[model samples]
Target: MYSKNVPSGFPRGFLWGGATAANQVEGAWNIAGKGISTAEVVKRSTNRKDFTMNQITKQSLTAAINDSSTTTYPKRRGVDFYHHYKEDIKLFAEMGFKAYRLSIAWTRIFPNGDEAEPNEQGLLFYDHAFETCCKYGIEPVVTISHYEMPLGLTLKNNGWAARETINEYTKFTKVLFERYRGIVKYWLTFNEINAAVWGFNGTGALDDDLPNDQKMQLRYQALHHQFIASALAVLQCHKLDPEAKIGCMLARMQTYAKTPAPLDVRAAQLQDQLNLFFTDVQVRGEYPNYMNRYFYDNGIELKFAADDEEILAKGKVDYLSFSYYMSTVTADDNNITKATGNFALGEANPYLTSSEWGWQIDPVGLRIALNELWDRYQIPLFIVENGLGAVDELTPDRKIHDDYRIDYLRKHIIQMKEAIQDGVELIGYTTWGPIDLISASTSEMAKRYGFIYVDQDDEGRGSLTRIRKDSFYWFKKVIASNGREV
Candidate 1:
């Protein structure tokens, strides 16, 4: 049966825009009073097996230094948004951007990671950047800590493990709340809280590998700390400016059962349980019953003090925001079933096509994901990341004919509008990337997902110029007509 159609247009004052992270887009890795982040220390490929927990010994850093002559900065000079904020903001303004979502680099503010005083230069950079967005009348949505934190903090204090991270994160939040009080009102406490459970495992939190048991324990512990930290940040926001809206962000990928069998149903249910376990604590201030049981069964006891629950309860989020790129399909299995090709992990939907990197393209799955989240949480959701990643060819006229991207967005926006019509209180929709920038999962530049094409490549060689793709014009019309134009 066909679902009901949306009305001709979106709600009044709907937000239509794009999202970027500081580490992915901000290229001044060490400039403007910034210290070395974990990203800077990364020399080998992240997709490799060792990427999860390979520690940066002195030997690795020294080897990096010795190889500096031969090694070009992998993340350095990433589209140069630090130096081109005016031009980029101008591009976003051209799209009638209702909001431009970006993150503040924590290291930029706390250079050594423990300094009580924030560097004036780091804070000033965002001050100017926010002013630029304001100049273009684009609302700025700021993420407190994206995937990249100061490497020094992780090496010494152990990222998100020690209680000290909560304090450090709180200080960072306090600085932003005090400084950008009225200029920016929308704040996400952490980039992808669910990722902590996954173990910087994919595109966020701590990107280290460990034994299966330790991985689960560390992930849960990190999440516990972040939940408390987010709650505290929310409380702090209310204290500083009661009108500010604070939300917890998660990397929410929808999962489906591969078939109608009971095991598939159970697999899909477990997937949902895994994703919502993070939100349940943040929104409801208590872990779900099944999740508690699972931890007990796995002997994964999370470390928490008496007051942590109180903090979470007091600081329940105002809204829920998430990034949706693709959906995965799963079937239950106790062992790796290499022969059947269906026993474990995601088997991308055969019915759907995939991106260059093999992420399935299912726009309707986006609607399914949205409705599922809304049904469970009941909080207003912001679709913070949904777009196509493709390989682009810069034409002779410096234009990218990216109709595939437009079609991808067009279908997703259609699903979003349908969800909104079906009583989903969606706050906004910002595609994965507004302009081309670095990829978070693969740390590659070729994974382009932008309405604005950035002139750069994986090797980091280009003019750093910006050109509007066809989707840029398409999105402008969609925003102008309140999505009815699509």
Candidate 2:
């Protein structure tokens, strides 16, 4: 898969890799001293068109927790990666991955999120996983807390809205830093940190029935606690391993104006600012000026400790990392047609195509996002997650000819190269899911995004076999030639 002609701007040693989350990929939700997580109780949405947060009231959560049916709760039986880590990492090594981005399930370590001592079994699990990656020369980029908060935290402290949750999370981070200091060098403080403000289901909030004002307040308060936790985690990571690189992860919903009208432009800018606010706090270590007005106008007051500002300043991240699967356009008018993708909604872009899931396919927007992030933070940016989620049919011979996924990835990689040429300091690119796992949004296996396919369905029935797709070989070549053989 090597090309004689290498890409011009792709510097040598550019980290090419894949990404997965514990809740989305790893099964064994109840094994190895792992506690139940908020992700486990999230029921699948029947209506795909309107992917709102599943109604997660206390009663529903309790029922789902006690429910013994893995078929109904598919996340409970992910891809069984917990038991198949060695086999999966071998495949990643076969693809010549420079880095593998995966999250450490918080519950795996803490079990209940406030434990006085870490679970040795959970620590040993990651210790062996990272050791295998190191054996294959694959760097592990670990997300400290990726959506899989222990359900106990939500029930006990109302998730991150309570001030005590911050201390608990800091304790979790301290354990991680002290334990995995040598094995994992790259760290992400939170996965999609802004989702709490956006009311995403995985932000550790289980009460979707609250009033709008109360909901907004809760979301922002949780966001504030997460911000403090992220900062403190960065500080803790540096204290443990000075060579470690910590970053803040954002959803990166790049928005464009529909027209040249000032209102339209302002709308797009405001939408972009709303998405960038999370990264702004982490990278700059201070809240952006515009957020004060936003808070006041919305009647949202954030509680902060006296030393929170100082802690944030001291704990600024070393890089900016984000997941960019699609972009959205915004118009000033209220009657504009809307498109949804990656948990964000916006006006549809008539100029661009869309994925089967209605995610706008704008390769150029990736270049725009990279340039914007680089210009804003003046720090290295990592493309932690980007991929197409589509249905795949296995032929009788057990093969998948997914040219659409190949095209999506090729176009994005080309745009990433263009961005690098345009002076964006990019650290690496890790496609969202290297192997097919349970979909985060709908909890369906059919919404596949991977070079490798796992034999599973939405109803939790399959032989649990792993097969390499055509794009798997294609990606191996791309990585081998350093993005030259697309």
Candidate 3:
């Protein structure tokens, strides 16, 4: 298949761009009336094991909040995107970005979760940012909350555990919808609503010392609240601007069976079912029946309001979007040699190679995932986050030759085109961290994912310069050619 081949190339007006999160990109954390966020409390960790819940302790979190050291908490520095967004957006425009997917920091607006008024300064920042995107002929695809929430919500409103966050999140969305309704047509309710199953990331400021069972219960309950909140956000967006579209995002860790054994196949099926439950509630407008048995077995009784089901049905997402970092293999046994993936827990596949961070590379898995999602849900799909994270070396000539990233993306894009040829109605593909920003899992700047290289390091040193890598030029051509040149 080549550029002349129909359905192999991207469709007309297909958005080619990049994605970043506010808590991971924007520094000036406390400068412009920004309230503390749970992201700020998350200390830096280079060790992959430390990226888990083990590192998030009362002692560590308390010190991170009080100490306020950018070196220790690299996310606090975040490549200084707050000051350099103009330069960054210019770079994106140069790369011919038809769209730029970025999230709004909730604390930036509310300062605290339970505020009566939004911070004017925070509102102004995004207002200018959106205007700049429009000025550069780039469409801004916005995410409401991307893995970070106001610390005030955790401390006071009890985070997502309490149903109060549903109303609070609606308030935040209402402000955003009303503020930039026309400029930003595409919206995502949450970055990865399903990741709540693996708790403590965005669920709020619950004590890390809680029992395992209690923690699981809290996460599901919080996820329930968010489902309602997302539904409410859908209604708000429609009422504010009928032309706009709102979608739900999933960290779609496509799962595979470790072997063809019946037990392994069944285990993988069960895992996939559980993973799809998040989108089921959002898209199909009700939780699936299997959840009843799972919840009963797990002692998780989700409380629901009288009108929750009605609200869910009324606010079905306009589209379905997701991030596909890597896929995993599941087996029936518990003691299998596990993959080094920090997020999606699974056994390593023998046929796959891993990145520097241990995430398996699976281009074919993306095609399978696209077919599965298209058949499962008939709505248009968007690959809002897909990229390679590797350590790049800048040559003495101030050039970064990151052909590894280019190869990774090219393979994924080829599979994406195959899926489109399979008749999957994919609308867009935005590679994650188009510019170098802090890593969400490890909070390390060294684990870079940008086509454009950042000058900063893990300790937050360097001039914070934005230099285009070899992948940058390669991607520029990819976009200009509409996925044909790659």
Give the higher-lDDT candidate: 1 or 2. Answer: 2
What tens digits encode model 3's per-residue C-alpha lDDT throughout 196-241? 7776576774747889888888889899999999999999999999
Pairs with steric clashes in candidate 3: none
Question: Residue 146's C-alpha lDDT in candidate 2?
Answer: 83
Over the stretch 1-486, how does candidate 1's per-residue lDDT look in tens digits? 898756545778777898998877887877778886655655535442122323344556556544532124455556778999889989999989999899888888997788979999999999999999988889898888777777667766777777788888888889989998888889998887765654542222343446678767876787788888889999999999888898988777677887899998998889878877878888887777898779988889888798887887899999999888777777786443211110114665778877666667778887887888899889989987778777888889888999888888888888888888777889898888999987665556777888888877677767877888888898999998888878
List lDDT for all candidates, in order: 0.77, 0.88, 0.88
Each candidate structure's TM-score, on Cα atoms with residue i matched to residue i, is 0.91, 0.97, 0.97
Candidate 2 is scored at a TM of: 0.97
TM-score of 3: 0.97
Q: Compared with the true structure, what per-residue lDDT tens digits does model 2 show for residues 60-152?
A: 887897896777778888899998999999999999999999999889998898889889999888989999999999999999888778888
Root-mean-square deviation (CA) per prediction: 3.7, 3.4, 2.4
After superposition, the stretches of candidate 2 with alpha carbons farther than 4 Å from their true spots are 1-7, 53-55, 200-202
- Overall local distance difference test of candidate 3: 0.88
